[model samples]
Target chain A: MERKLQERKVNNIVCRCEEVTEQEIRDAIRKFNLTTVDEVKRLTRAGMGLCQGRTCGSLMEKILSEEINKKVSELLPLKKRPPVRPIKIKLLAKKERESE
Target chain B: MNKTADVTVVGGGVIGCSIAYYLAKKGADVIVVEKNKGPSFGASGTNQGACPLQLFEPPVLELARQSLKLYKNLSEEIGYDIEYDNVGALVCSVDEKQYSDMKKHVEKKKKQGINVRLIEREELLKLEPTLGENVVVGVEEWESCGVNPFKVNYGFACAARRLGARFLFSTEVGKIEKDKDKVTSVATDKGKIITNFLVNAAGAWSPQIGKMLGLVIPVKPRRGQIIVTEPTPLNKRWRCISDADYLLTTAFDLKATEVSKDKRIKLGVAGVYLQESTGNWTIGSSRDFADYNTNVTMQTIRYIAKRAIKFIPKLKDVSCIRTFAGLRPFCYVDGLPILSKVDNPQNFVIATGHAGEGITLAPITGKLISELIVENKTSLPIDAFSFSRFKNAYLQNLG
Candidate 1:
């Protein structure tokens, strides 16, 4: 069973939100010589979906570290911006009004 | 590292990458030094990618026009898909005062031979039904377009690399050594690179590079927050839409305190809606003087959301997936970029201080700076953007 798993191609989906495959992430890192998650995100749209890299960020980092032959500690995590989760514009607007 | 190059461009943002590409294309030994891990990690990667030609006047307009023309064939020239879409842009007015203001502005633009026309509410709505009922008037600039900012930055870097330009990432430029008045070498954390010419294309960090040479570059970091909405079905063709106030306020350099007591105006909240090729809408933006801070405040995000909703109305239902901020390299001295060869540092050239228009002006900035270096003269007159103009201002501010 372990040998069969090893033989299987890297076809597993890394970022479900963007439907980015593991092979796609690995290829982008190798082709672009990417060292950062942000660069990979811009090139392949792996971490730019609704989840915003929350799910696939570490998976991508692992792939990046392996491709670049660098320590996982050396690779910076994906940048986290505001709106941790998707929120309706109406919610933000309502919050502003309530504050006012 | 090459250790020696004909030219060393600091900052691997769009400006630096573009300059490197142009310089390398001219057969000059070029080296790009970036403090970040990759290209476009700065403001170049964070902008909304709107090329609004109707926003400028005179010499600056000439640069914008030239840039727009170059963008038409840039994807093929660079052999990379920059996603340059010439879909045009709409500058809509939400009030009667703004409507009258736009009418006069449109007339001036028409006289200047810009392909722009003022449209009434009916025509404006027909063009963009997503706009709210408050939209009284709009000006359609047919020449304006939007490109993928990331792709454009990467395209230039990749093309330059293909053309034999050396890019040194994760490298911070330390000291710039000079022989008399001419630049001799640049000291980076990596090593000393001996180069005859140096181009400062550091975007918001231009002032720091200027400081290294004992020069005061009047560039400050002006924070602009932006919100990105989830992909939604568009009823009509995608067009870059912006509020008239955004252009007017930026053009006039209206102080937030002077404009109104309203918090939104104080925060410099302006609506600029752009739907990327991915169908996700990138909404923005709010401007504030936040020295090198790229953090998006909850208040600013809410204010931007409110302003966007005020313009599109349907945006109220759209979910905001993310919000981010970028610091524009705001040049306080005359609000124009100082793209000039400095007299003191003879071999040193300054090609920055493009605040919000970096994306729009990247190609022209690259071409003109390359011309200044290779040909020692430009195809178009750049005397207006010289550093000598800021000598008196810098002295006065220092005193």
Candidate 2:
């Protein structure tokens, strides 16, 4: 049924890295009156996972815009940090090569 | 928004929110104006959340003690769970020279009645089994703790709201109107707020606010980078840990003798490992005068990772989830916060320049600032932290 499908969508995992559900994100937005993606990320840990919100960044912005009745262009994306992708600490800790 | 209030607090970071909450609890009308969308968008939220008591000295140690007591009951008092973890801290030393230095530091702290002791490698390894073999000794402080930085900031903002404090988020303060020697109103992009007292708790931006009043608030932005790792069971039982060099790098501003030839020391990279309640280890910290830039460099990230691996070898296998940077409001004079009431601005208060200890000192700073405003005197001796101490320095800088 369409109604059952809609219910499943609410439980859909938005951020796979953190296992954060769409409903959980909605609840946090409503509770904290969060307007920005960074604020919601800090409160619900949506984008604070191994991938660092790279996959779910756009989806979160879309959801926020729809919930707040604002256009997608009006919403700011989640703040990006370094290490665009997850990197092993051993690789990062490896000493740099010396020049001749 | 209310057109008038007894106090107008600039900046909605943890310091401002805590001051607002304390003032509101005392039934003072308060308004906090923040340019950001919410609180803790700065260093307060980005920190590793460690409150190690072994790093404090003299007057600051007294404030840290009082703040620790407040943090124990803060969650209940604010009606919010701040995720406060009182697991204590370990300041590890990797060499005999550093161990001797730590022993002297411990003796000084013990004389000050601090609950700390120097432990050999045997006991150090017993406390943190995952620590690297290079760890020589550790100074264990039983009273240190960690808290969720975001929650602590948000908790204070919410509690202040509940106590009838108004927060004007996304509002930029354009000008501060003063009548001769007293603050009259604060003009923002949204509107002007008529207020009797104004508290400049803007952290790194306190200097700009001071510039508006023709005063030099000696606060500069010191950039620090931190890395967060994926959830690992290896750090499940570990308490907050740091290298003894971290104190020299942060508190003492790297004035100590050159201990290592590693370039990481130049970047102020020190090993500080803290496992959040979520099982993810937050490793940090670096210090540099990068103005207002908060970008985490690849080289700095690599240095921090190497430093972390030097402390906890198991961390070398863990995957880094993210890396971010924050700008600490470092005070140039004596490396202490400037919490005081200014005579020039009569009703203006300066509560900024906390450097790396903002989160650890928030509660006491708020209580003391509120006491100065409401009761006209503080419960603790704050004359040492007054603006008058920097009067000569300010005059010299002007000349």
Candidate 3:
């Protein structure tokens, strides 16, 4: 019998944007021994979505910070890039061809 | 290392990841934050992967077109196989009423400069012989495409990271500490992180994110239920099929539960999406009033499975193994998303309400958002999707 499956560990929200529960994030964090938020993002999409981290990033940082007893700034905010939304492949191709 | 990014993105969904990818490709110091293990786990992960430019609303259609083009070569550019399938889409009609509706829909689709065509039973059968014998006519858009939603999200995330972008996961925002209308810094569950600008990609959580800045982003959850069957030996060239009215899968009727107890009655062809690699065919989805919860109901599973089997009897041997649901964040009335700046506080840039199209509109949405933050010039015209449009009714009464 899968005892872990049978165990009723109550679920809680650790990341609200994606609706990822605390037990789940904690499990990943503990299992992975994650340190930075970026590692957590790769492991889990906790801060990804529309509200972005406007609502949940700090809370997750706190959860991890409290668990490890570190300042949030030590972890640092995540990075950003270009093409903030979905786009056309043809546009990219056109630009590529133009450059060549 | 006290490094500051050109911009800070809150969500790691396809929308957020795409934006990050673009900025990084342009040599912008980009940061993305995710709450789950990775991007595409929420609405981005669960919705259909239709990149259909033919069916989108006008302005959105333009964005969809650009997104479609990006998707065509994203696999090569992003260095990942997103499982793009331009095998075409079919809308099988069961009755004359639907046939007539489809005829009109096809006519309009052509007038809109789309390449959709109507096919009779013979052509439909030639296209998909395993289709139920009853399927009479179908609307086929040969150029329409489908993608792996999870892969799309992952591709953007991975591509963004490769381009010198950083992402923070398993972290939550505690407060948007603001100075007057300008955001000074963001406090996390751990500590404070300062930034020059904030992009709201919280999906269903957009409303709460706005509340932090004394702004109101009207976003709510529209739930969709899905059922998956055991893998079958389905061909790769096969297309995704649905009813012309398959779009109505979002609305659920709790009263119909009694009728479904006895016989398999398909309300409409609402749920339709497929995985090109997996034989586990996904079928009939319901749009329910249920909020943020990811619970699976037997009633919904039965109705969807039964209708899918009815549409294609080959499913009898392929027993259903799992049923799941996802939430789409939508703006109440305006079909457009909230992708504009807000008043009162300047640190927040809103980007929500992509609805079921988040997977499709992601790339363009991210592009436009980055332009707004970095160069302050949107590559595409998005006047119809501005956040200030709701000022008359919503922003005035924000909680």
**Inter-residue clash pairs, candidate 1:** none
> lDDT (0-100) at residue B290 of candidate 2?
85
List the lowest-lDDT window of 10 residues for candidate 2 chain B: B250-259
**Candidate numbers sorted by TM-score from highest down:** 1, 2, 3
- The digit string of per-residue lDDT tens for model 3 on A7-78 reads 533266656746677677776567545665654654565665434455677777877786667888776565
Q: Which stretches of candidate 3 lie above 4 Å from their native place?
A: A1-100, B1-3, B235-237, B248-269, B273-275, B395-399
TM-score of each: 0.95, 0.95, 0.74
| Quality class of the docking in candidate 2, CAPRI style | medium
Q: Write the per-residue lDDT of candidate 2 for residues A5-34, one digit (tens) a residue.
A: 999988999999889999999988887678
- Write the residue-wise lDDT of candidate 3 on B292-350 in tens digits: 87776555555565566555766656544445577878777564688887765765788
What's the DockQ for every one of the candidates? 0.75, 0.77, 0.02
Model 3: lDDT equals 0.68
> What DockQ number belongs to candidate 3?
0.02
Model 3 chain A scores worst on lDDT over the 10 consecutive residues at A86-95
Query: Using lDDT as the measure, what is the rank order of every candidate, best first?
Result: 2, 1, 3
